[model samples]
Target: MKLLKTDGIVIKKVDHSEADRSLTLFTKNFGKININISGIRKSKKRHLNGADLFGVSNFIFYKKEDYYILSSFELNETFFDLRKDLEKLNISFHILEILNSVLVENETRIGLYKLLLNSFRFLDKNNKPIKNYLLLGYFLLLLIQGEGIMFNINDGLYFDIENSIINDLPTFNKLTEIQKIIISNLFDKKINDIVSLDPSVDDAKSIILLLEDYMNYHLNLKINFKEFF
Candidate 1:
């Protein structure tokens, strides 16, 4: 009935038939939405495809019932660099999955949206080693903060392989005092301005595992961490 315009990232996509595909987008104005692009040309349709996964694009559509009927779109950034590395690709998908799972329809989360875009840009452009568990972990911390959920680094609670979460225990999975301090600093500092630190594989895994549990609990989501690995 009405035309809508917004900038969004393609978080998930599925082929509905040979002629059409559906996109799950995280937009700035609308939190999460599904838009369907119709009338496939078979050979010359990449532009309307919206740059595929993790791609940023501006869309114009008309609202029809529960979905946006895609009329036209302009490709912004496809983040093509992420496709070259499997680990980077997996991490980007995981971050997008977190956003898709935790965010709701028609709810505006500007902070989370910007963080997701910036995180992808950082990953795609930067030449750092694939030690980006901190990037993902910081997003979780920021999400918890944005939703007004109370979280403490020294809460002595974490996820267990056998159970979902453990709370009010002696220590958080044997994290050293210095490691805890570094993590707490991640929460205190701005995400863009923080000095990057090289956390070991074990350390990164622990932080992500802990954050997965924390975010799942707060968001009432049942997603697991094994998917990322």
Candidate 2:
């Protein structure tokens, strides 16, 4: 078995047998990995704390043919603040679910990693208004990386969700001008700097729905977070 060390965020954890766990982790160097973690609940272990949801860790693993065996882990960021509120946990889970479904193995996605880390930081700081911003930003980031959606900044035109660009107006007639501006600004602003700019809850919901349609049309993936709100 080949040994490897990498920084990873715990995406999901499922109880396997009596005392073992199957973890879905998104790593900085290795992308998504399936690792079996053991001896956490039964034995008196100190490092078992590293396996929490949204926990960032320095993981040492042994690569088998298909999956990796978690040998050791050093806890970095437990993101305990996110666990204090149900809303925060729900939002975090939604983001993690999207990443787990979209991102492929062995693909380097530094931008996505940074987005997740920054979102976690914002959640820790209790920045509620910007939650939708981060969510939309991550969706756009994934869309751009996967399909290369092009937009013309100068010419104000309709963005066809099916085509992933501002080419026609007739197809995307349902999208309003403000909605278009919101989508445009999502791509324009830096991920960390995205703010609501005095957006109402209803407006944010509309924008999220439009983005979901755009994503579905382009990437062919249905985001499950839409049902939550």
Candidate 3:
């Protein structure tokens, strides 16, 4: 059998056969995959720290009898500090859950992989606050597109971007128009570029909450969108 190597991040790790572990990895070349990591619990083979959650690594695995067995792995970036903080940890977990829900196993999506990696780095950089809603609105917009969900915005005036398209504008018409532009612009941004936007706290909250609602409607996510707010 031929061995394949790719850069991937661990999404899940589960105990198997006492010594062996089963891991789900989101990879650059293969998208998502399940591989058996043998003898990991034995102290001699414990050097593979890439088996932990959010561990990014270069993995070499070979298929045998239609199942994959990991041969070797070298840790790249564990985002360990991001894991230590409660807020960052929770956001990162939600990101993982969103990715797991939308992607299918063994489907190659290099763009999606890059987006996921950059998002992890952004969280780790501590360049911005975790709950202040940096790039999340834009990220969800891209995730919806990546997952092949179809949607259109008509002359549909949206009073609340989360709820529905409404024709009537409230008394704060100018403010509403500006926010509507913000929501629309989210779809046009690259994942990393979205962090540059500076909106008022009130506007940011509404925009983020609304985007979450929009994603919830389309993806039917198992994780609650409200928790991110």
Candidate 4:
């Protein structure tokens, strides 16, 4: 009976009825939600792009009993360029997959939402493959931080995976020099300055893979990004 409006990005979509579709959106106020949109599949022209994955839009909906039914939507951004480049599209989906995996339904994560939007905007504008990987590393670090695991990368000697900190002595998880530098810079530098690090593709992947381990240990998320690489 109550109409609600919020800014959301489509993270998943699936065919429902012949004319309706089901979508999973990560909204600014409500976090992840599943809503059914009618007539989109049959009449694709009016609602197709707005309902597509990775498009940010303002959505209007209302709850009917237990289901949220879509009333309308206005597309804000499609991040169209991401669709043009295969690699960019792959990387973007990788980020989205992580988001879809970690986000609990109806739990608001304002910081993570902002980080996701900004990372998409950044990835949309930049064409450098290395920069894209660096952004992925940056996004992953922030995602971990959002979970309250602060990674202390000061002059990195050894990473304490158990405590999620960096220390002078060797720990069970040893980080390479390049991985240490990349992690430190990602946390310390601004978005514009990240590209200045200009890490090799391999180096960038090393940092991301290291962070992936942290994700598994701390968050219990096992994401295999091998296909994207």
Leading candidate by lDDT: 4
Task: Give the TM-score (vs. native) of candidate 1.
Answer: 0.85
For model 1, how many clashes? 0
* Reference-based lDDT, each prediction: 0.72, 0.70, 0.71, 0.84
* Candidate 3: segments with Cα more than 4 A from true spot: 130-132, 150-179, 190-209, 227-229
**Can you tell me which runs of candidate 4 are displaced by over 4 Å?**
154-156, 190-194
| Residue 120, candidate 2: C-alpha displacement in angstroms | 1.1
How big is the RMSD of model 4?
1.9
Candidate with the larger TM-score of 2 and 3 = 2
Give the runs in model 2 whose Cα sits over 4 Å from its true position.
130-135, 150-158, 190-196
> Per-residue lDDT for 1-229 in model 2, tens only?
6789999998989986788888888888888888987776575664665787888999999978877898888999887777787777777777886777677887877777777787787787775655644565556555555556544433445656655556445554355565555556666664343353554556556766665666666667778556665
Q: Residue 196 in model 3: shift from native, Å?
A: 7.7
Query: Candidate 4, residues 1-229: lDDT per residue as tens digits?
Result: 7899999999988987678889999999999999998888788457588999988999999999888999899999998888898988988999988888889999998888888898889888997898898889888888887888776765556888777788777787777766677777888756456566665788888778878888888888888678676
Q: How close is candidate 2 to the true structure, as a TM-score?
A: 0.85
**What are the RMSD figures for all models against the true structure?**
3.6, 2.8, 4.1, 1.9
